[model samples]
Target: MNELFDQFDEFEDDLWGPIADDAMEPVADLSVGSAYQAPVEWNGIFTSPSEENNAYLPDVEPMDQTDLSSIQSLDSGELQPENMAESFFIEYPVFDPENADLEQIVGDPAQDMENWHMQSTQSSCALVSQEFILDKVLGRDVTEEELTSVATDAGWYTPGGGTPMNEMGRILEHFECQVDYDINCTMDDLSAKLEQGESILVALDSDEIWNTGADLDDILSEYFGMPGQDANHAVQVIGIDYSDQGSPKVILNDPGSPDGSGVMIPADKFMDAWEDSNHFMVSSGASQVSDQMIGNYYDRYGTWYYDDGTPERYNWDTGYY
Candidate 1:
C-alpha cells in the first residue's frame, strides 16, 4: 500500500511542477496603478466600545450645568414619569466589529466611507437589524448574506461604509419595507416603538456615547466637509429599562462593543449624545407592497418619479428612468 501511494504522489508532482513554477513567478515591472493593493484605512472618526472594567457609566463627573442644559434642550419632559412601563426588549442578533476583515469582504471602501473595521460593525448593525425585523416581525427567513448584498447594492457599504439616515430608510424600502426617518426624536418616542415590538437604528456622537475622546467637530469638518457637527457612530436600540427611577435607561446592541451585548446608558446621557445628530433614527415596518412588485414598478416607472407617479428622469447607464 505504501509503495503504491508513493508512486501516485510521484506521478502528481511530475505533472504539476511546471504549472506551479509559472504560477509562483512574480510579474515583471507591475505598474503601481495596476498592482493589487489592500483597502485603505478610513479617515473618519470611529467610536469603539470601551474595554475598561469599570461600570457602563463613564468616569467623568456628573452632568454639569452645561451638560444639563444640553440634555434639557434635547429632552423636554421631566425625568420622573408617573406611569412608566417595567421594561421592553426586542430579540435581535448582534454583530461585533472586532471580527471584520477587509480581505474577506468585497466593496468599494472609498465610496462607502467605511474602513474595514467600520464596515464590519456598521454593516452588521444594519444587516442584523433588518434580519430581525424581517424574520421576527415580518415572518421572512432572510439570510445574512442576502441582507449584506442588498446593503452593498444600495451603496450602504460604500467608501465611508456607514449608512446615512436617509440612505438607511431607502435601503429598507428596497426590501419592500417601510421606514421612518425620525429626526430630533425623544426617548419616549423610542420607548414607545420598542414597546410595540419595533427596533430602531440610532446615530450618536461617538465621543459622548462611548467616551472615545473623538473630536467629532473636527472629524466631520475634515471628512464630510460639513460645518456643523454630527453623530459619528451608529447602533440599534433593542430595549429600555425604567428600573432606575427618574433616570430611565436604554439598552443597546452596540456593534462597537467587544461582545455585542446589551449596553445600558442613562436616558439623559443618551439624549445628550443622540442630540448631536438631531436624534436621528430609522424605524422599519413590513410594507404592503411585495418586493417583486416594487421591483416591477421601478422597472416600468424608473427610479425617480414625480409626486403624480410620472417618470421624472431616466438614466440610460443604470437602465432606470
Candidate 2:
C-alpha cells in the first residue's frame, strides 16, 4: 500500500485544476418545500455530460446550491480544521421509471452499520463494507462477527493494519464472489456497473466521508502533501442520482458514518478524494461457483477452494498458497 501511495504521489503535481474565481456563486435555488435540491451549475467542478437519452436518468430538477463555503476555503488554502461543517447534505431524488423492470434494478439502498468512533476495528471497514453488499445486494444473512473471523483468518487484520485492495478481492472469493480491482476506473464505470445490478467497494481518504470538524480543505491539502499518511478507507457505492441537467451524483454506504444510511455526494467531490488512491475500487458480485456451497467449504476446510474443487491451501509460515 505504501508503494501504491508513492506511485500516486509521483504521478501528478496537482490533482485538479485551480478553482474558478466565480466558483462559489450559486446558480439556482431549485429548493421545493422542505426537500433539498441539486445545484444548477458548478463553476469549476467538471462532470461528464450525460449520454444521449440515458434511461437511468432520474426525473427531477438539478440540485440547489446549499452551502459551498468549504469549496471556496479549499481553493484559497485558508480553511482550518476547526471550521468545517458538521455534515455536507444533498437530497437524492428517487429513481423512478415507467418500466417496472428498470425500476427494480434501482431499488432500495443497502443496509449498513456504523464504525464512527470504533478505533480498535480501524482496518475492518473493508469487511463491513463487503458484509453490507452481501446482505443487501446478494440477499445473504452475514453477521459482523462472521466477517471478522474470516478477515482474521485471511490475515486482513492486525493491531494497526489496513486491508489492501488485493486482500479485499481474496476475501470476497471465499464467498464465491468475483472481484475486479481497478485503479484507473472512472465514476462512469461505477455507474455502468450499478446499472447492471452490481455493487462497488471504493477506497477513499477518511476525511472525505466523515465530518471530523476539520476543514475539509485542510484535510485534503494535507493528504496530498503526505501521500503515505494512511488515508485508505472503504465504502460501498449502491446508488446513483441524476440531476435535471443530467449530471450524476454518487450515493455511498459509508460504514464509518454515524447512521450508515445512504450519503449523497457530488460526483466531482467524490472523484477528487477518490483520485488520491488512484480511484481504487473493487467491483464484485456472485461468481460462477455456488456462494452457499463455497461458504460451507470455507467453514469446514478453513480455506477457499478453486472452481475445480482444488484447495487454495495457504502455507501459514510463508503466508502464500
Candidate 3:
C-alpha cells in the first residue's frame, strides 16, 4: 500500500509541475501596474467633551452698567431674582463652520469662528464611491490566461493577485458614479437592458430611502433577492441569471464580505430595488448614460421623506421627468 501511494504522489507532481512553471514564467506581453492607493487616514473633526462647556449660555450681563450696592449683594442670597432683575440666557446651536452664525454673537465673533473651524477640520475621510462596486465578468471562450492579460492591459488588477471591490473605489480616484444627481433612462428601459448581459453600476445612498422602512436583511432580500444581504452592504450588478427560477436573478459583487464575493438575485424585482435606492446607474458600454437617460435631477443629489399625508409635487427636473 505504501509503494502504491508513493507511485501516485510521483505521478501527480510530474503531471502538474510543468503547468505551474509555465504560469510563473514571465511573458514579454505581461505588465504589472502600481497597486491601488493605500487607504488614507481619517481626519474628520470631532467635538471634544471639553467643548461641552463651550455650549453653555451664561446669564451674566454688562459689568459697568450695574448698580454698585446690587453688585455688592451679588454674593449673598439677599440678591433675589426680582431685585437683580432678569438677565437673558441665550441658547445657540454649535454649527459646522460653513453654517456657523458667528455674526449673531454680541461680543467679538472671532472666538466663535475659531471653534467652528476646529470642529469642521476634524471630520473623517471616507471612500467617495464606498457605496458601489464594479466588476467585468469574463464571457464564454475567454480562458483564465486571456482574461488575465486583458485585465492587466486595462489597468484593472495585479499580475499574481486579485483586486478587491472596495479597492476599486480608491483606484478610480474620486468616484463620482455620475456627473451629477440625475439618472439617464426610465426604470423600464434600464430593466430591459439589465435583462440583457450588460454590466451595470448600481449606486446606493444607504443613508437615505432604502434604509428607511427596511432592516438590513429585508433590504438585501428586496435588492439582490438574497435574504441575508445587509443594509451596510453595497454591491455592483455584474451578471443576471434567469435559467431556472420564475424571476431573473442578479449577480452582484458585494464588497463588505470576504473575497469581495458575488451573489445572485431574482430578476423581476430588480427595478423595484433600483428605485428604492436614492441614486444609481447602469452603464451600457464604455460611456455612462445617466445624463442621456434619467436626466440630471438626481445628479449628486439626495431624497427626502415626510408623513404619508404631507403634500408633495412631481417636479420633472427633480425626479418625475
lDDT of 3: 0.31
Which tens-of-lDDT digit does each residue in 207-275 have in candidate 2? 554433345466554332233464777887776666422545566776654434566666777787788
- Which 10-residue window in model 2 sums to the lowest lDDT? 37-46
Note the clash tally of each candidate: 16, 8, 24
lDDT, candidate 1, 239-300, per-residue tens: 66554568666666554544234556777877887888788888865565543342225522
Query: Global lDDT of each model?
Result: 0.49, 0.55, 0.31
RMSD for each of the candidates: 24.5, 22.9, 32.8
TM-score of each: 0.47, 0.53, 0.27
Return the candidate ranking by lDDT, descending.
2, 1, 3
Whose TM-score is higher: candidate 1's or candidate 2's? 2
Give the number of colliding residue pairs in candidate 2. 8
